[model samples]
Target: MVKVLLLITSAVLIILSLLQSGKSEGFTGAFSGSKGLDLFSNSKERGAEKVISNLTLVTGVLYFALVIIAILGQ
Candidate 1:
């Protein structure tokens, strides 16, 4: 049961992470400095973006907790 939950949680985490928008323009613009140091700029996450971001965060925490529980149960 623990293993199944772990797998599901991990899968959800991965999916949520992928669904999020990229903060930067990848290595090309950031390293090239072509975007004028806007890599860490304040890009507001609203609507679906905000929801997905929050879900990703929550799922990450849940996944970590599940991993610890599994380890301790062994």
Candidate 2:
């Protein structure tokens, strides 16, 4: 049962991770606040981006918890 859960969590994580949009700003934007770029104009992720981002974070935490449980079970 734990193995099955681990597999499902991993698959979901992979899918959610892929669905997220790539940050085009790169390292340059990290050094300086993304103020000039129109591409980075949107300070917040709206719509599907926001949903996917939240889902990814939730699934990532679930995955970590599952891994710990599985390891401790063994």
User: Could you say which candidate leads in TM-score?
Assistant: 1
**Model 1, residue pairs in steric clash:** none
Candidate 2 lDDT (Cα, whole model)?
0.87
Which 10 successive residues of model 1 have the least lDDT summed?
Answer: 33-42
Tens-digit lDDT track of model 1 for 13-71: 88998898777677787678676457467878899999999998898898899999999
Give the range where candidate 2 is weakest over 10 consecutive residues by summed lDDT.
Answer: 34-43
| Model 2 lDDT per residue over 8-67, tens place | 999999999999887656668766876335563555889999999999999999999999
Model 2 misplacement above 4 A: 25-43
lDDT score at residue 61, model 2, on the 0-100 scale: 97
- In model 1, where do residues sit more than 4 Å from their true spots? 35-41
lDDT for position 23 in model 1? 73
